[model samples]
Target: MLPQFFPPFADAVSLPESPASSSLGKALELLDLFSLTSPLVRIDDVIARFGFPRSTAYRYLKELCDAGLLAPASGGAYSLGPRVIEFERLLELTDPLYRAGQQVLQEIGDPGAVYLLHNLYRDKVLCIYKQGPDVIEYEGRRITVRRARGLPFPLFQGAGSLALLPWLSPHRIRQTYLRNAAEIASSGLGDDWEAFRRVLAAIRRKGYSTSQGTITPFLGGIAVPVLLPEDRKLVGSLAWTVAAGAMTEERVESCAEHLTRAAQAIAREYVKVAADM
Candidate 1:
């Protein structure tokens, strides 16, 4: 029999008690515990976190191992498995935004700047692609582009997140505003829904958004949304980041112009590709 594939972070309590469903739930839960800061996990760590019995944890881990979702490492540790590499490869192959965004970045984005393509997933801005300079300094440590992908930013924060706000329906906008009112207020956008709506209106009129040190401390960004031409639906955002000190008015305007152009090109390509498909 073929092994059942488990969706990422599936809720265990929601699934019916078929053997595959039961096993898949536990496997997904196990995988959810892995993250950039904690990439490797031991059975004891899982036990400590989830309070699962040793045998039960081992069973779940073994199932994931057999399914190629987790691989054993030294000292009884397990890291994310080769299947993740395959899944990312499949994502790049299947996702239109990645290809179209790459083209947009190459054409309009500054070669030395940091550019990110973000999509709204589960109400958060997920960084699906990142293009960075040869050395990017984050919190005084230099990192590469390969290390920056897949990082998620909060939906109600950052220039990229603000760029997407105007595209949401009024009801969703109000809901999101209410859910994140305090944070939004703290960020100086608004203290209430009315103020927030005004801010979004201004962003829509300008065709882009800019923020200083909102997502990453000491960094600023300018972002524009990619909208589908036919239905005007929001697909994602294209954003460029620079050091906070370098975000002069002229530089911000220039970045916004570049971002807007790239966003328009990406949207056109995305719609064309979708129509062809």
Candidate 2:
């Protein structure tokens, strides 16, 4: 929402407006500058760029950090902290897509062993929503979801990654690919641009991807894209990891069908929720 100082022209013409003091406004503006692509920021950078007084900015920053909204980075920088991660987890837990998918996942075979993976713009697979299964037994093999954070896999290599790639703007997709190019190529995405482009093109054509040898060994990924109804934008990917030994060609087909259906159901829920807003 626009602040009173930046009131709509129509409102400004008709209403007597009292603009906020510069310091308060600048503090809020500083927070807005942090984003996925640039998460870490320095206090001096914020003050110089946003024109907030150093004292005023530090007061705000100190409160924000003490309240767990932000945290001090190494060398005294600041970044979004544990509180925001907690809030995001709360949102995902409450999200209708997550809730509906949870129920559907339960109804399908082997609910105790099933888990769901979702991807968002910044952190890739936002987190795993595990219903149960401290250790999954699939085809007589065990798998576990331990340490959900800091698992970095290319946004191009897994089904969740490929599912997200087509939804991003061409510029953003290219930027992300380049950002992780050297590391992703180590996973055999390809060594150079031409080869990487070919891989991305194939993912677009195939409409999904099956990535083996991604984050967890002996676990294969199956992903499908979910389209937001409002603008038909691809929001994120829905994927699950299946034990590789259990993923015969037939099981792979089943996974695709099941995951696609779940994606559609979740997308439908997202549309309804968005419309309510």
Candidate 3:
């Protein structure tokens, strides 16, 4: 993996009941507990969640606090620490894709659309950077980008998420399809493997993906894969969302044209930045 770059994708797989992981890995996993519903965690929460022994749980908490990933909170609990903000700053400054995205977004310059930059993290799709229109809301409607950094969407959902499907290796694609066949069908990809392959093949040929209200009601998305110019390595995606009713065939084609141009520019910028590093 390249230092200061986005981490690569992981396979869609499940963990065993008592699988072995390093102490550091387990400590970092504690960050997953800090979500919308559970913003803080106590020692007992850690113990109950992971079945870690009392002493081991305390030790892990200490390690996390020392690392600046977690900090003590009111009433003997822990919350995500200030270091996460620092890391976000670091990413905005140094990450090639983000730096590139900033440039491409301003270049697009269209209002009433929710712009997004997505990257594959672990087994799910993550919206790393999101920006709503600055000038006005979408025709008197407020557009919200649904996928947050902490809350990831599945591989088979949304245009932004599904846009990444064609870029994965065949083996990984097969693995994901097998693991999520029901979801694939529900998303209208196909119930069977052959149909799933065909649908993705068409998406790969067209070089973008679009969906209407599949993930959010009355919303639609158009996404194009971003790849390294030289090696064609999949970086992530550049996508935008707008009112579902506005997406006629001509409109989608026009939107796709604009998105493809932006994605190519971002990919070229990423390549140049990577070379400089």
C-alpha local distance difference test of each model: 0.77, 0.65, 0.79
Q: Which residue pairs clash within candidate 2?
A: none
lDDT of 2 at 192: 70
lDDT of 1 by residue, 20-114 (tens): 25656666778868987999999998899878899999998998899889999999999999998999998787678887887677776466788
- Tell me which of candidates 1 and 3 scores higher on lDDT: 3
**Span of 10 residues, lowest total lDDT, candidate 1:** 1-10
- Lowest summed lDDT window (length 10), candidate 3: 1-10
Tens-digit lDDT string for candidate 2 (1-277): 3222122222222222223345454455556568767788888887877676888778878877886878999987899879988987886666665665565666665644445456564425554444445565776667774424334444655666667775566555555555677866886777975566666667666666787656667777788887765676776667767776777888888878877887777677767765565
Of 1 and 2, which scores higher on TM-score?
1
The superposed Cα distance between candidate 3 and the true structure at residue 159, in angstroms, equals 0.7
The candidate scoring highest on lDDT is 3
Instruction: Using lDDT as the measure, name the better of candidate 1 and candidate 2.
Output: 1
Ranking by lDDT: 3, 1, 2
